[model samples]
Target: MTTGRAAQARRAADALRQRIVAGEFANGRLPDEQALGRSLDTSRNVVREALNLLRDENLVTRRRGIGTLVTAHTYRHGLDRLAGLAEELTPYGTVSNEVREARVVPHAPPAITRRLDIPERSEAVYIERLRWLDGGPLSLDSTWLAPDIGHPLLHRDLAGRDLFALIEEVTGAALGSAEVTVHAVTAEPDTARVLDVAYGAALFAIDRLTRLPDGRPVDVESLRVRADRFALRAVLPRS
Candidate 1:
């Protein structure tokens, strides 16, 4: 038989799990135990017990030095469907966008020019942005668009708007398909600054090249996300 205090703690743990799954508390941040206790009208010990329950479930992990951290959860999307960033993060919370830099600049490196099929000296629209969940930076996105089709993109307000939708609107081109690669990389200085992590923190880097209906590559994007903040998951048909 469970005591009333134990039962209360169990209830609190369940509520906290629901809130996390519902995206009330975001990644890389932990909820305050005292505050949670106050909100739940329980004692600190009860809250601690509740947190212990969550820890056992593997939904959260206790670092040796750092406090508890919410482990990355898997997100599933349909194979044939494309969802905007905002839509994809809707389950987490209200996603916000900050346009750090948006300008037309001369191509700098062969990495971008080679993919976009543009000359080294050609100008391309360079867009840098930081995505936030619950007002905290979660990912840094950098993209280069070819000069021929990117000039019109320079004159738009992209805040709170999906880049893919904006591209379709400005160029009248539908996104047919995209090739993407995912890898883990140590965060660089700029990426660390935008993501609010240590200089050498582990990050998930996604490189993607998207094409229009006619197979013309329109954009090349590199996305850097904090390993603790964002996660990618896929489901496959069983053999």
Candidate 2:
């Protein structure tokens, strides 16, 4: 069935994305199409589709002579600077992601509207994902932004893609500053399952409302990170 084949292609893409995020291809190139097909348990046609999706998202690029080359999509985390969740973990190890949700919201919620400063009736794009480092669960992020910014994002494969960069690129509204809040919380059932941790486990929650340089709100993000899996450090110099 056509639907079945579509599902297979999506699965293939997800698996490949996970591997890419996991740093399995440290040489920075994917296996040949046939080899990928065999390893991913899909046909060459399916493998081609998966690769195409990754290319569309700018995760990898094809060359005339060489195979797909992984793009430079990483940023370093700074203690005294503002950055995205992915950037915050660069000092740790290799980072990857699993996208759980990506779609459009017809009616933006009040809390979302308040943060992004969009109209109540306007739609938005919602992206929920779980990030990984060296094959272990790391953090879960739920992000929402204006529809104009989210529309183009709805089509691409997101695994292994940097959410912060994609948001700024499509929206043309880079994050100049953010209102951040930190909290200690216990994991809920859904959160536990996604992060592969026990329910009621202690976690660190980072909430941020980001704004563009011109004072326009860009996005609101909630990141629930596993306590033992990540560390946050900073330095201070007295005047």
TM-score of each: 0.67, 0.64
Candidate 1 lDDT score relative to the true structure:
0.76
Model 1 misses residue 118 by how many Å? 2.8
> What C-alpha lDDT, on a 0 to 100 scale, does residue 22 get in candidate 2?
58
lDDT of 1 by residue, 1-239 (tens): 64797898899998877676555666645667788889888888898888888776545776766776776552332333555556677776777789999988875478778788777777788989898888777788898998866777777766787788888897786788888888999988978887888888788788889888888788999988776556565556678
| Local accuracy by lDDT, each model | 0.76, 0.77
How high a TM-score does candidate 1 get? 0.67
lDDT per residue for candidate 2 within 1-239, as digits (tens), equals 35676678888888887676656787888889999998987799988888887776556788977988776332223456777766767666777888888988899898898778888767888999888877778789998977777788777657876777887777676668888888899889989888887788778798888777887777788989876444455567888
**Highest TM-score against the true fold, candidate:** 1
Which pairs of residues collide in model 1?
none
The prediction achieving the highest lDDT against the true structure is: 2
Give the lDDT of residue 69 in candidate 1.
Answer: 72
The residue ranges of model 1 lying beyond 4 angstroms of the native Cα positions read 1-80
